[model samples]
Target: MLVVGAVVLAALMLPGVWHLLRHGLTIVHEAAHAGVAVLVGRRLSGIRVHSDTSGLTVSRGRARGPGMVATVAAGYPGPALLGAAAAWLLSRGYALGVLWLLLLVVVLVLLQIRNWYGLWAVLVSGVALVAVTLWAPAQVQTVVAAGLTWFFLLGAPRAVVEMQVQRRRVRRRGGRDESDAGLLAGLTHVPAIVWVGAFLAVCGVLLAAGGAWLLAAWPVTGITYPPWADVPTCDPMCPSAASATAPGLPFSVCDSEAVSTPPEIEPHSGRNESLSLRRALALLDVCARETDPTGLTAAEIGRRLGVHKSTVLRLAAPLLESELLRRDTTSGRFRLGPGALRLGHAYLSTLDVESVAAPSLDELARTTGCLTVLTVPDGLQSRIAGHRPAPGTAGRAVPRLPSVVPLHCTAPGKAILSVAGTALLERAVAGGLRPVTPRSITDPGELRAEVLRTRRRGFAVDDREFDPDVRAVAAPVLDHTGDVVAALAVVGPAARMSAAAVQEHARSVVLAARTVTRRLGGAGLGPSAAAGGAAEDLRARRGA
Candidate 1:
């Protein structure tokens, strides 16, 4: 198995065999140029991917502006940078996020693919990713991600070599130079060789950094072993605070003098340093969750985070001064402020999931005469990222739903939860299911069974479980890494969303989910036959 894996990895790295994979890198390369152009306020005209592993991203902006320079510089380093980013996300357990990001990039690029071949290439690749994301197991997703990272890291430098050859050819032919390196050289008054060197430097650094990160992320146990087998190692000799300090000491050791011990082996100090950083990050997360109309006070924040009010105050002080959080003078309550809004906007602006799914959502809402909603997973819960109302529904009564919904009750919530592993599900329901209605599944075992049923059926149903009158059916949206990033649901009143209506709407909802998944670059539909079973499921449910 190891030898086979080595062979596969080596094949993916070799340029001769690697051309089979170069299309993806080419798309990323062109997308990087377009992304940078748009980020700098340039108008992206279109993108063209050629059969020769080259692509062009055309943008309109100031002729001699920084945007042009950045766009020119982006092409050669794009794939390497993207691969490094994927490695970084994987290292931090953001594999699904990376997949969704890549899928978004591809979908964005597809909108501008100027040729039939380019469209075909992108569509096929996207479909493949969707299939893997929706059907493949988590381990397969990891391998697919790692393979992509390796291909990009190893393939980028070779492309630089090709650029150098192209430069020489252009010189011999006295042809108008067109390669990205040549264009960059012309723009910067730098030699083509120098541009090539810069490309090499960037690709080389990414290769080394990404490789090291992937190695570190690799488990000590064999790949076949479950992730639980790879236990986190901790320092056995690290002394507890109670054991390290004298038994009769009255004063707390949290003071500055606590570090008066020998510097050579202050394990307690090292732990404190680590804890300080972790506590700050945890405090930020706790505060970010305070989107409630009534902001949380220090006392409430401390209680929720399992810390003392003094500790919460101390931790919040830096955030308050940084303006990442706001405090109400009258009530001493804290909420996310302008700085957090800026951060949220920055992230949302880059995430193309909402943009890609909007059209499908509109169509689904129109076709079903039901409410269409997109929900993205946020920690243990799911948040309504986008909402679409049915056509010609103005002035009609609509069901009100919370922006944040627990993973146990709603259709969209359960759809996302179904894709999460048992460990994550357990963690999500640890506080127990909050009943939104009398029919809500509060028992952990029952909820687990329901999630499993959702997995089997490829859709989740909330038949007045979340709200007494609201009914919904949701399908999980998978990204390129086979992780469920979001859910798409069609919701309506229980009277209209009868068993037959659910069966009918369920098809459209699942299809919309699949469309979003494909747009994001997930592809394997044949193996699962998710849609093929839709009719059969509807028949069964209607009979019941």
Candidate 2:
């Protein structure tokens, strides 16, 4: 159970996974708008679910009025509100209630679904919830509830990202304003980006509230509280409390602790207290990074968090007991515990990219006779999310697969970089292009020109820049809104994957990348598309 939470937690923290799981939130988002339209005395027209995970909720009402604004505003915040409700239910140990509510919502959505596909989607989702609620074991139901809660909490923001992306695309194409963010922009005379921020703020607040409640309701169980917890007025007993005599007081008092005032809260002005709390929360946030559990020592954590080593240990003590952090006995080092994995897994299970792209990537590997990897951007690098090994290549000595690849030296990274804007590209190489090999481009200007070349070519080639005597070719995987969300790469030895083989594999890699991109509800590389333009420019430049 703890491991599930930990996994979900880690997975939720990942932006890459969030895009993959944003579809579930889309259903709720449309449902929320429809529900509000009905509540506000508007006649429902219909709801349409698109292949791209975007949806439309139509209603008949005054062209411009409070009802219209309410309906438009409800769509974006719908998932967050629903998720907040679910979290509240989970925190209150009403997991069964959460399941039933989800079923009810799905049923309601099914009734309003306009098209056959939409009907099928909502019906299937609703029936699944019903089956689980009716036939699944109690523990299974609880897990489902937890998973649903985490999905709502984490997936809501990614949906917002999708909305923002859509908004940008629509602005670029001079298309109709259909997004909730776009609608809110017109309603309040605020920019769409600001509206996106408002939606994010709502989701963030709800997530924090729901997460806190759930944690308190079902926290790690092995930790024993100190005797001070038994003290009658020592609420949330202070970990740093010290004994001090009280002058002319009937009862004995510590420096800050009294029967009347809790020692856990220091006597400070409101602003000071708020600042202190923010700093403490910042420390907690530092320790909660997905990589921190297995990566950082206490001293390293303190340095990163900008606190003293003793202070870090002091603050981490309660978390350790809570099983949020586990200490390795031999090295006395700390890493995230099972709880983090639980959260990570919960978030990952909701995503279907691996299942969706497996066959395509496998085919690419077989066709190219090179290791095919599926990767997504991770800050200034690309992380391998999935891979397919080339045929009859299992027994050979291959390079170790990397969980993360640096942006400047890897084909997958360069492919993604090709589509990035100037500012983002600058940030990516801000740390300076470190040399992985003598051939690696260390100069920022050279790397920038290479990125532009990759953009023109609609793919990237890493010629032993990352690994000595190894070569790779990669293509970007676009999302529905034409955003480069991931990359597909074919990698092999420098000797065997010759210039001719590189050209051959590059075609197969580009085709495979487009296949996965289409499956993800994104645009294909056509004549008018930017990807197609790049390919055209590349061919013209090379006189191919």
Best by TM-score: 1
Taking the tens digit of each residue's C-alpha lDDT, what string does model 1 give over 300-416? 877665567897888788888888888999988888878877876675456577888899899999999988999999988899999888778799866676898888998998888
Which candidate number maximizes lDDT? 1
- Lowest-lDDT window of 10 residues in candidate 1? 247-256
User: What are the Cα lDDT values of the candidates?
Assistant: 0.71, 0.69
Instruction: Quote model 1's TM-score.
Output: 0.41
Q: Compared with the true structure, what per-residue lDDT tens digits does model 2 show for residues 1-544? A: 3455577767766866654455567789899999989999999998988756778888998876888888888876787788778877765446678889998888888888898767867777888898988787545677787788777776777678777887788889999877877777787788878888988898888878777766644421111111111111111123333342222111222222211122244456556545444444445445554344355677876665555678667767766676667778878777776765675567546646666678878898888877889898888888899997778877886657979989988999998887755555678767788999976878776676677666644568887789977888898887655778888899888768743577567657766776677666554433245444345435433541
TM-scores of all candidate predictions against the true structure: 0.41, 0.39
Over 4 Å off in model 1, which ranges? 1-9, 12-16, 220-544
Candidate 2, poorest ten consecutive residues by summed lDDT: 220-229
Q: How many residue pairs clash in each candidate?
A: 11, 26
After superposition, the stretches of candidate 2 with alpha carbons farther than 4 Å from their true spots are: 1-6, 9-20, 219-544
